[model samples]
Target: MKSVMIKNKYWDIAADIYYPPGFSEDKKYAAIISAHPIGSCKEQTSGEVYGAALAEAGFVVIAFDASYQGASGGEPRYIEDPTQRVEDFRVVTDYLMTLPYVDENRIGVLGICGGGGYAINASMTERRIKAVGTITGANYGRLMREGFSGFDPISAMEAMAAQRTAEVRGEQLRVDDLLPSSPEEARSLGLVETDLMGATEYYRSDRGRKPNGVNRSMFSHQAAAVGWDAFHLAEVLLTQPLLVVVGDKVGAFGAYRDGCEIIGRAASKNKKLVELQGWSHYDLYDKPEPVGMALEKLIPFYKENL
Candidate 1:
């Protein structure tokens, strides 16, 4: 593995390129770009787990930090703009095409968590991406507009409106934790044993914590994300082969349902949904069993389609 940087109009993306064992520059190899979840860095689950795992499976892989987050450059840090995130995928694709050891025609993408949704949105128009795969795919817009059980939209909208107004009035950006800071805090907030608890354990614990992986994100990000749909025009525009993976045990607001929705709406005749039994949304991030299960299917799917 080697560190590399790709310059985009908005920022220079920090990335790591993982070479397959015994790789040679003389031969072109199929490549995959792995994207981390929102408010995460490349060194987190996406790069440390799936990127390395896929490289070991004989594919060149690149994992990158999203612009305005982690090591990537941009102003007003931690902004989670879905449109810009999708464009980041395209810019990475452009970088891959320039590599001498990468097979331009066989490039694929793998996105974890919110990155999955961004991958789907990117694949719609970026036909150069021949194959796309998503793990625990989440549509941030849907989540922001409608909470887990679809009961918090009004309150959520009101909060967002208040925040936007504050931003317009020149208030400092408000940053909030994406999940509770601790298991006890989660329970206190009535999130015990739910997906939020699992997420807190992963992001706030030794299991997956990294310095740049701080759970905080800007409140203004919601303004941009609330209206963006990852599956917009997926029925007519997403012709590339798609693979959506989710844990069978994932609960409400989990990407399992989003995966199903994508499969139902996508025009691709070659799409498939694979579920990892007994796994939760966060379990797939770095847990050996679930990550292994995911790669078993992902390796062949990209091989066959890319």
Candidate 2:
């Protein structure tokens, strides 16, 4: 694996390229770009795990830090703008196409968590991505507008508007923690116990924590996040082969249901949904067993389509 910096109009994206064993620059190979979850970096979540595993399966894989997050260059750091995130995938695809050892026509993308939504959105217009796969897919827009347990969208929008107003007045941007600071706080907020446990263990504890993986996002990001839609025009534009994976345990959560909805709406005639029983949303991020199960299906899907 090697580190690379992809130059974009708005930021320089930091990425890690995982090369297949005995990879030769003289020969072209299928390439896949793996996008990480929101408020996370390449070193965490599926970016590193899935990228390395896919590379070992004989495909070149690149996992990158989204602009304004992690090691990527951007101002007003940690802002989760869905549009820019979607464009980052396109920029990475452009970089992949320029590589001597990458097959431009066989480029694919695999995104985890919120990145999954961005991947699906990007694939709609960026036809260069011949195949797309998502693990525990999440639509941030929906999540931001309607809380996990169906909070009032209007109140959320009002809060976002107030934050934007404050920003306009030169006030410091407000930040929101991705996970509760403690299990007690999570419980007090009435958050799902399993969701809180997984998130806290992954982001707060040493299990999946990284120096660059901060657990906060700009409050004003709600402006862009709430307006964007991962499945927007998917019925007409998402023509590439699509694969959506989700843990059976997460089906009760909105993200899993959103993934299913996306698949049903996508125009891709080759779309498929694979549910891994006994796994939760966070389990597929880095757990060896679930990650292995995901790669088994992902490898063949990309090989056949791309």
Candidate 3:
């Protein structure tokens, strides 16, 4: 496995292109572009593990930092913009297409967490991607417009509007601190309260924790809160194969299930909703056993379909 830098116009989005050692460059291989979750770099859990696993499976797996985060080139570092994130996937796909060893026709995408929503969004608009999958996926627009299950749209609007006003006033918008820096802090952040399950372990522990990430930033909340509708064209995935992977023990899993149901209903071909037994939302990020299970399901799916 080797880490390489690929240029996307003005931005040099840092990425790692992993392949089996001594892998031939002459063979045209299936390609996969993986998107990491919000605030996570390409080195994080799901992206790092899956990128290596899929490479060993004889596919060219490339995991890149989303714009404005990590080593990727973009303005307002660590910001989250749903629409631009979706476009980042398309740009990555285009970059892959230009690779000498990548078979453009067999290109697929895997979105981890919020990246999953961006993947779905890209799949609907970008026809080049033949297969799509998500692990502990999120619908960015859905979450922003509606908080959790009984999300208050009015509050979401107020928050976004306030942020927009701050932007217009030339005030430095404060990035909300949602991620915990340590185990003790996780409890205070309400990330792991009482029986909240694996979120605390995921974000605070070494499992999913990163030293440099911001843990919280509402870069897209304002845009998504008012007029953004992520699933508006999800029905367009009817012709493409879709895979939804989620942990069974967290609130995110339910959202994954609901989104899967909607896409499954709209999809005309292969579609699967996988619930990893006893797994929690954060467990899927870097944990080997669970991540391996996801790759096992994903590789075969893309091989057969893409």
Give the candidate number with the greatest lDDT: 1
**Which runs in model 2 stand beyond 4 Å of their true positions?**
148-150, 182-192, 251-253
Q: TM-score for every candidate vs. truth? A: 0.94, 0.94, 0.88
Instruction: Name every residue pair that clashes in candidate 1.
Output: none
lDDT ranking from best candidate downward: 1, 2, 3
Worst 10 residues of 3 by lDDT: 191-200
Number of backbone clashes in candidate 2: 0
RMSD of 3: 2.7
lDDT tens digits, residues 1-306, model 2? Answer: 899999999679999999999999999999999999878899987556899889999999999999998889998888889989998998999899889999999999999988898899999999899999999988888887676325676766677899889899999889887787765667678865665577776777677888778878887766778777888899999999999999888633356887889999999999999999999888888889999899889999999998
When 1 and 3 are scored with TM-score, the better candidate is 1
The parts of candidate 1 lying over 4 Å away from their true place are 148-158
- Give one digit per residue, the lDDT tens place, for model 1 in 1-306: 999989999579889999999999999999999999877888988898999999998999999998888888887888788888988998999999899999999999999988999999999999899999999989878887777315576666578789878988998778777778877788888987657787888888888999888766777556677778999999899989999999988676659889999999999999999988899898989999998999999999988987
lDDT on C-alpha atoms for all candidate structures: 0.87, 0.86, 0.72
Q: Global lDDT for candidate 2?
A: 0.86
Using lDDT as the measure, name the better of candidate 1 and candidate 2.
Answer: 1
